[model samples]
Target: MQAVITFRQFSFRYKNQSEPTLKNIHLEIARGEKIWIAGPSGSGKSTLAHCINGLIPFSYGGEMSGQLLLDGQDASGMTIFERSRRIGTILQNPDAQFVGQTVGEDVAFQLENEAAPYDVMKTAVSSALELVGMQAYEAQGPHELSGGQKQQVALAGVLSTQADILLFDEPLANLDPASGAKAMRLIDEIHRNQGKTVILIEHRVEDVLLEHIDRVVVMNEGEIAAIGTPDELLAAGILPRYGLRQPLYLEALSHAGLPLSGFTDLSHPESLKPTEDGSEPQGPPILSESQLRDRLEAWSTSVLPAGRGSLGEPLLELRGVSFAYEPGMNAVADVTLTVRSGETVALLGSNGAGKSTLSGLITGLHKPGSGEICLRGEVINGWSIRRRGEEIGYVMQHPHHMLTQHMVRDEIRIGLVARGVPEPEREQRTEEALQICGLYPYRNWPVSALSFGQKKRLSIAAILALQPKLMILDEPTAGQDYRHYTEFMEFINRLSGEGMAFLFITHDMHLALEYADRAAVMSEGRVIAEDAVARILADGGITSRANLRETSLARFARAQGLVSPSRFVEAFIAAEKKVKRA
Candidate 1:
C-alpha cells in the first residue's frame, strides 16, 4: 500500500507555549488502511490528528519542524481547503462543524462551494445521506436531531465531498454506548465498501478495536510508543501501563486468573477454545466456556445486591413536572423523581429524552408547566437560577461552557469569589478543590493548557467549591480514558459518602453500574423505571426499553457462553468493581 499520511520527525509548539505539544513524532499510514490511534488524555493525540488534516499550521498559529506528507505529496504548503479534498475530519462535537440549518443544506454545502451543478449536488447529497441511513432526514433541521443523528449528518457532509481519507477525532465521545457501536459499524462499512483510508483518534479503545483494523498505534507524551496489529498490542498486556483501556474480555480473563496466552484471538470471542473444568488441561486454572460464565455469574450475584440499606430524607423532589418550549409540545412531561441526601442517583435515557429538560427544572433554568420542584420539602420552583446554584451546583455537559477564567486556580475560585467569599477562605477552598480534582499541579497553568478530561475535572472543582448539597453532572466521564474514569468516579463516590448527593445524567453504563446507588431511566419525557443499578442492568427489558446497552464486561460474559447472561453479567460487573475497589 502507498503511504497517504506521513509525519517525519515532526514537532509542533503552540504560540508562547514552552513545551511542544507534539515532540519528535514519526508516523506513516497507508492508503485504504483503517488505523486506530490510542493515547491518554494529554498525550498529544489530538495534535497529531490536527496535523494530519492540515489544521495545526493553518487554523492554529504554531511553530513547527520536519515534514508532513499527504498522498505522497508535501502537505506543508497545502491550504486546509486543499487538504479537505483528500482528507475529511469528523470532530468529537459534530455540532461544531455544522454550517447549515438543515441536513440537506449541510451535506450540499461543500458541493455548492465547488460550484457543482444543481443536479450533481442533489445526487451527491442524497447519496451521501443514504450511505449513513439519513436519507429521510435531509430536510430536517440538524438541531432537531439526536446526538447520534447529528453525527450521521456530519459524516454525510464529508461523504458528499467524496474525501478519500477520513480523520475521525473522538467521534464516539458524545454518543451513547449503543449509538457509538452503531456509528462504528457504519464507519466500518464505509471503509470496507468505499475503501477510504481511516485514521481514527479515539479513547473508546475496546469498541474501536471491534472493527477490522489494519494497525494500532499507541502514543504517549507526544511520541509513538508502539505500533502493531490489534491482537499483538491487546494480548501483549501493555495498555494498562499507559492508561489505555484494554478489551473488557481481556480484563475479565485477567480478573479470573486465566492465562491470556491460551486464546488464539481476543477480537473474535466466538472463536475461543477454552481449557477443561478441573485439572491442568490445555489451559488449566482457566475455566471452561460454561465454567467461565458460571464464575462470572457467581461474582455478579455477589456484587452489590438489588437494594441498598436506606437512603436519607429526600434532598430534592419533583412532582408531575412538565415543560415545553412551545404550546402543546412538552420536552419534559409528567416527570416525578427524587434524590436523597448522600445518595448518587443516575438519570439515564436516550438523547432527546428530556433528561436535560428535567435538569433545567431542578436548576431553575426552566419553569415547570404543571408540577412543583421541592428542595428539602420547600418549594424551589420559584427560585432563581442563581439562588438554586447556592444549593445545587450544576456542571454542564460541555466543560468549556462552564469554564470562563484564564487560569486554573482562578477558574475554580470563580464560584467562591462570585458569592463574596473571603479572600483567605476562597484561596483555601480553591486549593482543596484543585487537590481533590487533581488539578493542583496545574494551578497556575492557562485554562487552554488543560486536556478535555482535565477541563471536566476543573468544571467539577468549580462546582465543588460552591459547597452545594447536591450536584448535577451530565456525562462527567465521556471523554476520559479508563484510568481517569476510575479515578474521577472514585473521587465522586467518596464525595457522595460525605453527605453530598448527586444526580448523574450520563450514557456511560459503567459509571452508572459502579457509582450510582439507584438509577432512574427516562424515555420520551417520562421516568419509566427506578431501581438499583444492578437491577436495571440485569433486566434486559428495562435496558432495551430505555435504549441502553450492557457494559462490555457483561457482553464478554455472555459471549463466553454463560448459562444465564443477565446473572453472569451482574456477577462479572460486581467482581470487577470489587477488584477495582480493593
Candidate 2:
C-alpha cells in the first residue's frame, strides 16, 4: 500500500517556545489504515496531528525542519484550506467547530463553502447525518443537543466533506462510556466501508483500543517511544512504563502475578481461555480454569476490606428543587441531595440528564422553581451569586468558560482579590495552589499558551485558592493523563480530610470508582439511585439505565464465573486502597 502521510526527520518549534515541540520524527501511515497516536499531555501528539492536518505552518507560525508529505507531495507549503480538501479534523471540543445554528446547517456548512448545488448538498448532508444516527435531530439547534449529539454533528460535518483521511483529537474525552463505545463503532464503520485513513489522537488509550487498531504509536516528550500492534505493546508491558495505563483487566492480571505475555488476545477478558475446538493455542496458557479460579479466590480472600471514615455534619442541602429552561420543560426536576463536610460525592448520569443544571442551581446560577436549598440548616434559595460564591466554588466542564485573567498567576489570585482577602494571604494561597497543580513554572506564562489539560488544572487551582466550604467540579479529569489525575485527586482527598465537601459531575467511571465515597445517579432529571460508590457500580440495572458501563474488574469477575462478582470488585478496590496507603 502507498503511504498517505509521511514525516521525514520532522521537527517544529513555536515562535513563543524555546524548545522544539516535535523533534527528529520519522513515520509513514499507509492509505486506508487505521492508527492511534497516544501519549501524556505535552507529549507532542497534538503537534504531530497539527503538522499532518496543515495547522503547523498555516495557522500556527512555527520553525519547521525537514518534510511532511501528503499523498506523496511535500506539505510544508499547503494552506489549511488546501489540506481540508483531502484531510478533515474533528477537534476535541465540538462546540469550537460549530458555525451553524442547527444540526442540518452545521453538517451542510462545508458543502455550502464549496458552492455545491442545492440538491447535491442536501443529499450529502442527509446521508452523512443518517450515517451518524443524527438524522432525527437535524432540526435541533446546537444548544438543544447533548455533548454526544454535538460530537455526532461535528463528525457529520467532516463526513460530508468526503475527505480521504479523518483525524479525531480526543473524541472520547467528553463522552460517557456508552456514547464513547458508540462513537468508536461509527468510526470503525467509516474506516471499513469507505476505506478512509483514520488517525486518532487521544489520551484515553484503553477506550481507543476498544475498537480495532492497526498500530499504536506511543510518544513521550518530543520523540516516538514505541510503535507496534496493540497486542505487542500489551505483551511487552510498555505502556505503564511510559506514564500510560493499560486496560484495567490487564492491570488486574498483573496484580495477580499473571504474566501478560501468556495472553494471546488481551482485548477481551474471556479471550484468556484456551480454544474450545482443541486447535493449536496461539500462546501458552498460564493456567486452567480451575487453577485460575483457585488463585483469584485465594488472592481476593487474603485482602481485607477497607473501612469508610465517618462523615462530618451536613454542609449543603437541596430539597425537591425543580427548574425549567422554558415554561413547560424542566431541565432539573424534583431533585433532592446532600453534601456533608469532609465527604466526596459523585453525581453521575448520561448527557442531558441535568447534572450541570443541578450544580448551577446549587451555585445560584439558576433559580429553583420549587423547594429549598440550604447551607448549615439555613435556607439559601435567595442568596446572590456572589454571596454563594463565598461558600461554594464551581469549576465548569470547559475551562475556557472559567478563565478570565491573561496570566496563570493572576488567574489563580483574581478571586481572592475580589473577595477582599489580604494581600499577603492572597499571595500565599495563590502560590500554594500553583504548586499543588504543578503550574508553578508556568505562573508567568499567558493562559492562552497552556494546553487544554493544563488549563483544566489552572481552573481547579483558581477554585482551590478560594477555600470554599464546598466545591463542585464538572468533568474535572476529562483531558488529563493518568499521572496528573492521580496527583490532583490525592490533593482533593487531603482537602476532604480537612473538612471540605466536594461534588463531582463526571463521565469518567474510573474517577468515580476510585475516589467518591458516595454516588448519586440521575435519569430524566430525577435522582434514581443513591448509595455507596462500590454498591452503585456493582448494580448492572442502575448502570445500564444511567448510561454507565461496568468497570473492567466487574467484567473480569463475571467472565471468570466468580460466585459473588460484586464482592470481588469491592475486594479489589480495598486492596488498591491499601496499596495506595502503603
Candidate 3:
C-alpha cells in the first residue's frame, strides 16, 4: 500500500478570505484504495478535493502553504493539466458536464482535445462506455437518458481520460435510491476491476456504505477529524455529533437503549448478534438479549396507528392528466392526484418517471395534452404560468435558477412588486417571508455570499412572499447537510401546520418519511400508488418497480423477524416525532 496522495501540514486560503479553507491538514491516501471524505456542508471537504484536483491554486487562485505530493512528486510544480492527467473529477450534476449531444461524442471530447487520431478517439470512447456498461447508449442523446444513465455517461467521459484516481463530489445528491445504489456498484466495479483509487465526497453516507470502503475520513472545519474503517467510525459515534446522519438502523439501536459498544462491527444491521455466552452486553449494564427483545416489542406495540386529522378542502387536483414532450411518448399519462389544504405530499419516482412533468402541468409551465387540472375545485387548465404563480409557487431544484435580484431582500420583494400588491402589504409580507425562512439576518447580504442551503431558503422566501396556497418544491434539500436539512424541513412542516400545502418532488426518502404525510409513487408516466409514507416505502413490490429502496429501519425489522415491519416502521416514526417534541 503505497501513498498516492500525501498532504503534510497543508493549508489553503482563498483570496479575500480571512482564514484558510483547509487548516494544517495531514493525510495520506494509498494507491488503489477507496475512501469516503464525509462532513457537513462547509466543513472543507470540497476544498480538500479541490486541492487534490489542482483547483485550489490553479483555477481558484488560492494562497497555499506546506506540501501536497501526488505520486511522490510535489503538486505545486505541476500544472493543472498535469494533475488532471492522473485525477479525473466527476461533478454532482451530470447534466452540467455534457458538451456533446450524443454520449459517444461526449466521451470522446477529452481525447479530441489531446489531438488524438479519429480511430484512437473512437476506441477510447467505446472502451470507456463498455467499462460503465453503457455502450448501447453511445448514440443516444444525453437528455434521452435516465438519471442513472446520465451518471454512467459522466463516468465514461472521465474514464476515457485514463485517469487513475476518480474523485466523485456528491455523486448521489440528485439520484433516486435505486439509481444511487447502482452508481455505487459501478464505482466499486471500477475500483475492483480497474484498480483505480476512488475518493468520494458526499452527504449520503448511508448510500455510499452499501459497498465496501477501505476507510472513512471525517473532516470538520478544514481539518481531518478521524480516519478509520467504517466499523471503527460508526462505533465512535461521531457522525451525528458533527451534523451527519448515522444509518437509520444504528440510530434505532441507540434509541432502543441497546449499547453499540458490545458489537465490534456495527456497519450493517445484519451484523448485530448476541454474545457467545448468555450474558449482558459489555461497556454498560444494559438489558440481556431476551430483555432487549421484550423492551423493543413493548415499545413498538404501544405506538398508536399513524394518521392525521380530517383533511381540509381540496386545494389542487388532476383528473386523468396526460402530456408529452414529443409525439407518441407521454411523459405523464392518465394520472390523477389531489392535494388538500395544509397537507404535505411527496411526488416520488425514478428519473424519467414523469414526476417533474406532472408538476409542469400543475404550474401551467406545460399544458396537459388531455384531462383537467383543478385548483380549489375549479378547472384551471387554461391559466397562464403567471396566473398560476398567484396561488401555486413553484421552486426549481436549483435555487440559483429562481434567484434574480442581487440581495436577499430584493429577491423576496421583486415578486411582490411585480404582482402590484400595495406598498404597505408588500412590505409586511416581505418581512414575514424573510422571518419565516430564517433569512432576515441575511436580507441585506449579496445572494452570492449565501451558502447553497441559504440560497434554497431564499428561493422559498421569494415564493412565500407571493402568499401561494400550494408550494411545489423540486429536490428541496439537494445539497443541504443533516442539520440544515432538519432546520429547513422542520420550517416547511411548521408552514404546513399553518395551512400551506406543499407538493415535494424529491428522491430523498428520509425527507418523505419525516415530513411528508403521504407519498404518490409514479412509474412509466403513471400513478402506480398513493398512500401513507410508511406504507408506500414498506411495499417492496412498489418500491422495486418505482426504483426506490426500503428504509434501513424496515430492513432491520425484517431481519429481526418482527411481526409487522411496516407497523414497526410506523412506530419508529411516531417515536421520533415524540422525541423531537420532548
lDDT of 1 at 53: 83
Can you write out model 1's per-residue Cα lDDT over 31-141, one digit (the tens) per residue?
899998888888888888888887787877789998898878899888889999888899888888999989999999989999999999999999999999999998898
**Between which residue pairs do clashes occur in model 1?**
299-571, 300-570, 300-571
Give Cα-based local distance difference scores for all models: 0.83, 0.87, 0.86
**Candidate that would win on lDDT:** 2
Candidate 1 has its poorest 10 consecutive residues by lDDT at 276-285
Model 2's alpha-carbon lDDT is 0.87
lDDT of 3 by residue, 515-544 (tens): 889999999999999998888888899999
lDDT-better candidate, 1 vs 2: 2
> Model 3: which residue pairs collide?
none
Best by TM-score: 2
lDDT of 3: 0.86
